[model samples]
Target chain A: MLEGELLGVFALTWQAAVMLGLGGLLIYLGIAKEVEPVLLVPIGTGVILANVPLGGLTEPGGLFAVLRAAGIDTELFPLLIFIGVGAMIDFGSLLERPYTVFLGAAAQFGIFGTFFLAYFLGDGGLRLFDFSFTDAISIGIIGSADGPTSIYVATMLGSKYTPAIVVAAYSYMALVPIIQPPIMRALTTEAERRLAMPTRAQRVSRRTRVLFPILSILVVGLIAPKATPLIGTLMFGNLLRESGVVERLSRAAQNEMANIVTILLGLTVGGMMTARDFLRPETIMIYVMGVVAFALGTAAGLMLGKVMYLASGRRINPLIGAAGISAFPMCARVVQRVGLEANPHNHLLMHAAGANTAGQIASVVAGGAALVLVPFFA
Target chain B: MAEHVVEAPAPGKILRVHVEEGKPVAAGDRLCVLEALKMELPMVAPVGGTVKALHMSPGQTVEAGDPLAVIEASP
Candidate 1:
């Protein structure tokens, strides 16, 4: 060993320095700005650890490598996260207003629309980026606004941009408050936003609550078998929560299981963000396209909301339509806030929640559809 | 007869109050409307009695143990 190469900081390259800075930025955003603290914190730590020269964190037989293989590559982590998500969500709103499912289905327009645009910019057309058909489909799923579905689909499709997709999905989810409001306001007039919806829905029976997960799994599985694993695990967790027979399991799934999987998933995603892999033109394009997909999804949901409003003789507030972006309670809160801004007494939370929860189911179906269609066309 | 109190079934805002002092109510009568998690749940009378006192009003926030109303048990 007569080499003069340094062992640590002296051996770090400019690329590693840049990645380290990016890692610091992520950590700052998480801690100071509170931008998705749960995810960004671990992701930042993973990025820093991976960028240290000779750390072997990402090398073969190393920690990051083993994590990637065990969780992401196998697509187990995302599915497990779904179980936790399912346990936490209460679908009573969606069950009360069954028709809101249409808005949810319509919001998926962004996924297909973005897929087409992404394909056109990549190998399918201009060759500006290296996006294959699978990459484009996985990228398009950012419109789902769901982190686990995006991770599950991207990992299953074997996209090289899994890290970018995951980051974009989580980042945009946090930005739902900022990104969705302008679009919602632009789509509806003052009168439309001020329109009040029924504050109370008929109380759902306990038996109906118990049956919902079972029925959802059956219906969704029958239509989209590829989505069965994603939908099945999600519903299974929901069943555990609603069944009232497994309180301990439900609590664990909601709290302990969810937290553990989130940490592992965030770290694995961040570990993939080494400079050589992440600092690329394609990554930029993916981020840009992700925003477009989210916007288009919101717009499509609004359009569907307008249609439903007109069909309902203007009883349905078009503001609730924006909640169909599948960003869960955040999107619902945005809709409610916008509604209150228009009319101080207008409480649109229940209606917005109906559409928001519907989007959750629809996005999963869209993910499943993409899984099936991409292979056929590619 | 001793007075029996009815507490909030869940933590939420009282959207509506359907009973008043001295109102005759049945065991299964809806006493008030509590909004929680976007669903409006009826806080019903657990036992038939005369409404003695109402502790909550519209738009009031209630906790699980917060007494909503008091009923004088029928003899």
Candidate 2:
């Protein structure tokens, strides 16, 4: 009785032990594998802290709970992070090739496709799992490949599986390098991959740069009002960046604010992952659906790329289509690498960056569309 | 001699300059490596020629259309 009262070891459940191990594994992946060490490391530490018996960090009014309430529940952290992301992004490439916006829109099919499958397997049809309308939408958002958008959507929808969804979103995003290459290789012929796009595109004017974020806000907000908050903050940051007069504010958003919020957001997300909540069949299914979402998104993008390739008389590298998944620079880098592998002379970086940035806007719109449409259907 | 000016394809930093002024190069031969958006882009010579002048150096930042090198077609 004394030992039980004094030692946390005596109170530790097998579930908690498993969570501790999982937390350790996340740390290992972050430190050793260098897979998004910035977020993963903080998340891992939070997981360990939350699972420690008697720590109560995740209990009512605890540190994790307070952070979660102030950040995740209020949906402030992800929104703030978007500001940072916008400041970091250079839409010059996208402006040079506005046609790539279709590629961005094409990739969003993954979100809807995964939603349909999740709904069919759950409350909508098979009744295999407890995924309700909102749960399915949250799960579908894992395909957004943008962590902030996934969190914002999942939280806005009030999905019970927010922790699982966020984990899957971040994990799969880091795995973009591994998941995309096989699909890209299988979909494109050697000749298609080797196609070289013109390196020089029309340079965007300073006026166009400054007008882009404002115009995007007006267009996207008018079309998807629900996404206004998400897109608003994002474009606001970009406006600061392109304004040329707000260098200090833009720098703050990109560096100091982004770093601080990332730490809080990562830790809160990890703290939410209690073993009882995370070790469920539905959680496993969410992970599976995440892979499906990414694959489907990649496939859809590639198909459009193929269409564009033929339309352009094979001048457009179909590989650039794969960058339309909103994973930002990572997807663009993958396109460049794969293009190089197929032909050393092919440089697809600028073209891929265009599609990749377009994907960023498209994914935000898709997230807004989901927020608006899911409730009407539910 | 027909002189051709090779320009930067995008805004980035020169990571390495593989050619020196007065050196000969073939079309498609690497001229320098540019780092942009966290990826390395290897800039290549557009025509076979003797390098007449270089406008870029390692670690220098360049904008799109900034001249990186000038090449004179081999007579």
Candidate 3:
């Protein structure tokens, strides 16, 4: 009673110190390098808080734990983010170019391919890793290149590596600029990247815009009911934006709601990254497998885009196919930059955006499919 | 001088008024920035002109086709 513990230093273990260092690194990257600062900063701060000795931030009833329960564990934050994402997207480009959906679908093969590898390594037959079928599926969902979908699937499957999976998903997303370009360059040639796409897209009707979200929900929900929550929230947000009746509500969903949920989600995810859990070899393997899955997804998209380029009589820029990984404006921007590099006068932003938006829809569909398939196999 | 009016593309808030009344601008110069659907879209000068009037200000909301500014064509 006379000497109650004062500072957390005496309780600080090497693992905690490492985690704290890692947290500092994340904060550095967020502040100095500006790598996904919106996410990394909060996550980095959470990591520091959780790793501090006697902090109890990750313990039951703690702030991070509470946030995790309310948002990540319940899968509310990701879904809420989807509404913001949906409202923020303008699907007119996708509507004008429907065929790009094929590229999006093709990109999803990475999810399945990575699943098989992860299963074989962990639980399927090889047992090379500690990944159970559930764990493998959770890791594989990283290929979706979608943060919320990854969170939802990992949580739904009850994987032990949810933290790793979330980190991988967001990290890879932030690296989209660096990751996709090399693959895009490797897959296409000077001519292919230089291929000029039509500048103007056919105007999409407002009725069509309204109907697209509704029709998508029905079709997707009917096909993969498990994906209903993920897809449902996304389409709901899109519908709110497209309906032309609720401007204030849509804006709020896009800005305020998105920002609040993102902060909660990022912090909770970071809080989960305690050393004992995150330092395992399995976690390392998850990170490795995540890169593989993302690369495969990107390659598959490029391959499909090449096919479309050939099929469309060379009118399509295969670079746009690389945009099918659902990294949103980043992927589209990458494609546009590559296109312009090959041909200074060419403008591929809209065309790349078309495929990019389709990729967004397709990633959601793939996530729904994973929800259905993971349970069937696991 | 010929009068040219720039219109808003969609409903959004004016995030930035890049030019003021009587400022000379060339074609493609950004006159203002509009925040819509969480995207920052710039309203560019449609033609070489002098900004005659600014119909909107930062933080003001706008609707599709609402006039944003008026430019007097330069000859």
DockQ of each: 0.05, 0.47, 0.07
Ranking by DockQ: 2, 3, 1
> In model 2, which regions exceed 4 Å deviation?
B1-7, B26-29, B45-49, B70-75
The pairs that clash in candidate 2 are none
Residue-wise C-alpha lDDT for candidate 1, range A275-357, written one tens digit per residue: 99888899999999999989999999999999999999999988888888898878887886788678654667767788988
Greater DockQ among 1 and 2 belongs to 2
Per-model root-mean-square deviation over C-alphas: 7.3, 1.9, 5.7
The digit string of per-residue lDDT tens for model 2 on A28-128 reads 99999999999899999889999998888988989999999999999999999999999999999999999999999999888989999999999999999
**Candidates' lDDT values, in order?**
0.87, 0.92, 0.85
Q: Which of the numbered candidates is closest to the native, going by highest DockQ?
A: 2
Which residue pairs come into collision in candidate 3?
A: none
Q: Write down the TM-score for model 3.
A: 0.84
- Sorting all predicted structures by lDDT, with the top scorer first, yields 2, 1, 3
lDDT per residue (tens digit) for residues A145-170 in model 3: 88888998899888889999988888
TM-score, one value per model = 0.86, 0.95, 0.84
Native RMSD of candidate 2 (Å): 1.9
